[model samples]
Every structure is written in structure tokens, then in C-alpha cells.
Target: MPHIHVRHYPRNFTEEQLRAIDEAVTAAVTSTFATGEDTVSISLEPVTPEDWDSQVLAEIAARRDELIKAPGYWNES
Candidate 1:
């Protein structure tokens, strides 16, 4: 079982864009782990920029070492 969670700012992505993201992410995960699409799960969360520091950044910072793929933008000092 593979579970993937994607969090991003909800600026102005259309429904098609979000669907595309879901497809691409699922494909990547499936390809990397050699899993069936039916066995993979993906969830997309939209967080506001204002609350990113408290909601997302804080959690990431706490588990930084555990993250296999951390975004470069958030790592910049």
C-alpha cells in the first residue's frame, strides 16, 4: 500500500490542473515503487500561505530528516 499526500497553496488552480496533478503524482509514485494504481492512494491538501508556517512548515521541520523528498523552496534560508 502506498499513500501520497500533496499540500500546496490554493492560489488559482483550475479543476483540470488539480486533476492533472493527481494523475502525475499517482503515476510517479506507482512508477517509483512498482505498485498498481489500484493499490496507491493520493490526497491533495490546500493550505493558505498565512498558515503554512504553523500548519505545514512546523510539521516538516520536526520531521525533516524523515522526508524523502523535501521541497527546495522551503529549505532556503
Candidate 2:
């Protein structure tokens, strides 16, 4: 059960865009894990710049070791 959660800056993503994102993630997850497509779930979170540090960065710091991919543009300011 691989649940993919993507956090990004706020943007108005349309249904088509969302579907495209979900499909791409599903393909990757299924191919990598050799699992059924139905088992893969995807969610997108829009994090504003003002709240990124407190909300997203805190979680990233707490789960640093568990992150498969880490953000490269991290700034303390």
C-alpha cells in the first residue's frame, strides 16, 4: 500500500492536470512495487510559502531519515 503525497506551492490544478499526475504516479508505483494499480493512492497538498516552514519543513525535519527524496532548496529564512 504505497500512498503518494505531493506537497507543492499553491496552484489551481484542473481535473485533467490532477488525473495526469495521479496516473503518472500510479504507473511508477505499480512498476516499482509490482503491485496492483488499485493499491496505489495519490494526494496533492498545496502549501503556501508562508506556511511551508512551519507545516512542511517541520514534518520533513522530523521524518528526514525516512524520506526517499529530500528537498534541495531548503532555506532557514
TM-score of each model, in listed order: 0.78, 0.86
Give lDDT per model, in order: 0.85, 0.89
User: Model 1 off-target regions past 4 Å?
Assistant: 75-77
Q: Which candidate is the best by TM-score?
A: 2
C-alpha lDDT of residue 29 in model 2: 94
Model 2: ten consecutive residues of lowest lDDT: 68-77
lDDT of 1: 0.85
Candidate 2 TM-score, true structure as reference: 0.86
Candidate 1 lands at a TM-score of: 0.78
